[model samples]
Target: MVFLLFSAATSFAKTPLQPILPLLEAMPSDLHVTVPYLLSFVMADPLKMAMVSIENNLSPPETLQKLSESLTSLLPLLSQLADIIPRDALLWKLKLLKSGAAYANSRLHAVQAEVLFLASGKDNLLPSGEEADRLFKGLKNCRVRYFKENGHTLLLEDGVNLLSVIKGANMYRRGRQRDFVTDYLPPTLSEFKKTFDEDHKLFHLALSPVMMSTLTNGKIVRGLAGVPDQGPVLFVGYHALMGIELSPLYEEFLREKNTIVRGMAHPMLFGSKYETSRQESSRLDTVSMYGGLPVTPINMYRLFERNQYVLLYPGGAREALHRKVCLMSPYLY
Candidate 1:
């Protein structure tokens, strides 16, 4: 809702999204029909962009007809979606709109919008994965969740649940300030079952991983009773074989200590590098579902501020993936 509006006023101020446009500077996208279909209505009465979405107001029939013709030439797709929406034919117009339109990234760094990039792996239309990485690096408050299995229309996909993503990311808030501790929502019943009983079932049973904590007095013992049950606990672990140590680490802690060990994981896992097509998805999903976030100072600060159990692997993936390593050379990149 726009503030400072006069009810009787016929005009509302509007500006092109030139500031928000260059978010992912080189974010590559095809001339998708959705762009034109979207722009078709808004572009029709460019001056009345805000009014387009007002009560009972709609775009002219000719605008939709123009979009239909453009969609028709795309063939079977045109046949299937012609009655609905098209993507390819009008994609170029989006490119032109992006390039030809007045744009500037000067305010990019200052923009404080909380950005969450949900990139689709099968999205041939645009490589949002690449954009996720760029935005994560450029934006001050940004997070990325790359679904390698999803398509361009991520939220619409059966497997891609938007609500779950926001919940898992701890993006929910009550007011202007976000209390990571208060706003944090633990995994629900389905999420718990999916992460433990289903996704990591094999490892949870077959490996039956174990954890032992050291008491302040120096003696080590099984169960979390030895460790402090309070918050702001830090557990630094050596990288294990293919991150196999993660399941037990997260599971054992939650089961024994009733605490979730938030892993400050390599950005590659949460960013765009970890590909399920090559590596197994179970391990990957575990990292995300069970308090695992991209390694960033902000993430570290948030976990600690929430007084949650923090897990960090100094070796990261390098230690797990490196070969012909010597014990003396502890650090692997």
Candidate 2:
């Protein structure tokens, strides 16, 4: 009797009996042949049975329903271990192991917009592209591509290729947009003509010996010079030696020409006690009567409205006295 029992146990050991048997049983002849033939029954008999008993005793549920739920959860994990151990031969010796399912779940949720999976040939941990593909399977809108002849630190090794890939992806996304081109030819031509006319007037003024000599030496020469006498004209020039040199020249030019030139002086000039005195004030009032507009913030806006010739220094003071030798370029606003 003991010999028969031992033989039955050996057969059962070689085949791993299902923890939760199927609700529908197999036919008697089918079960007898298949169950005994399984390799797991031959190799994992007494030890497996002992382990199962111990597991059940330690992890006993309060209710039958809880036991069923526990078995359901464990079966998938056991199957995963069986699959993993054979493929990854190094893990075959491990009898019990924990999975990274929780970590994997966390990674899946953390993915927001996109993911870049970079794999290298030399990396021992993830040598095959299959591992990276498996991990990214759960991710939505994720792509995986391999870098040939590159190792674990692929980014460092293949920086140019990586950059090319990123640029290509960006170009692909941006190219999907619709492009509209409208004709700006008429407006552009009109603006060009107006600018050309203004440039021609400036070119003529620049040739004047008084204007040229005044600018060359550090003397100031401010005046109104434009067509349509009282129309809106901008008198652009260079200034040197603060307001001392410029003020007298501006007064003289306006008085001689009998044309209003609104000189836009810096606030610093007017803020001075000497320049803002009663005597100077009287002189400025006299100049104002003979067509000189002393540009204050209050009257500057109004002067422009009346189509008056306005004098302006684009550089203010910084560019005017930048160095002892002046550069030949106009200081643009």
Candidate 3:
């Protein structure tokens, strides 16, 4: 791991690493270290004390049941980790994040590698910002894949097709081997029909999604009627309410215009740095296959140069929170 140093904002007490005895006893051998590592931020000292107090207040049987319930929910979130990251080590890693100035774009530009940056949209620790964009821009050969809805632990998230993503990346380097499968491929009409039918069924069963269109001259036209049926178009829009608009909008475009909007995303969708676990590796692969590329200006420029319909949300995570200012802002580029 690369170490970057910057002046500390506040001197953290030089506390000793916490013991792993409790974690080992509480979890399985395979998950002995991984769970605590991922949950370090989540189960910070304060929160752990709170949980202990809550448990202590309960009867023995009740406490056992509560622990069981909590662990069941927490285990899944802890899935991607490969090993138990030592507390001191994890803390040191976190310090690097706190010292963000250490990983400047100028420094990143010095490295020569095919970097695939996967940024999380809901990363609480290192939230999305201009810094990611700057680093992406500075890189020589880099691709970005962003997960618009996921948190920092994308590798542990559901529905990520990791194999397809790797295949796609290799294709990028090897002149587009068309025979390989990738998550990026638009669903075939039949595939879409099956999935859409199910979604349509659910949509009608719950809150029915209504699609509106415009009238041209005298006749009603599809939403994408004016868009060229050829190459290279960009669609800019707001990310509203956890980007609820994304699915409906994509479905609408495919239904009406037969267009697939390639989205620019944060890099976390690609995977985690500590992809020690097979499960985590699998999840990142799924994200790549789904055509989720990292948010980068260069990637967008190239897509436009190649004539693809790209989807861009100027207001990213900020707008998704339903903040009025974020939603009402004129531009967020």
Return the TM-score for candidate 3, rounded to 2 decimals.
0.39
Candidate 1 TM-score, C-alpha based: 0.45
| lDDT for 75 (candidate 3) | 53
Error of 2 at 114 (Å): 71
* Residue range 64-89, candidate 2, lDDT tens digits: 55545544554454445434444224
Off by over 4 Å in 2: 1-227, 243-252, 272-299, 320-333
Ranking by lDDT: 1, 3, 2
Q: What is the lDDT of residue 27 in candidate 3?
A: 59
Best by TM-score: 1
lDDT of 3 by residue, 1-333 (tens): 122111111112211222533343445554445655555563222223224324234788887677667655655544434344544555556566436545442366576655555554554444432334544566555454555555544454443333334444433333332222222465555445533564344754464566554445555564656566767877777765665555566667777777767777655444343332111223234334334466778778877776777877776656656564443322332
lDDT of 3 at 235: 75
TM-score: which is higher, 1 or 2?
1
lDDT for 37 (candidate 1) = 46
Which candidate leads in lDDT? 1
lDDT of 1 at 81: 44
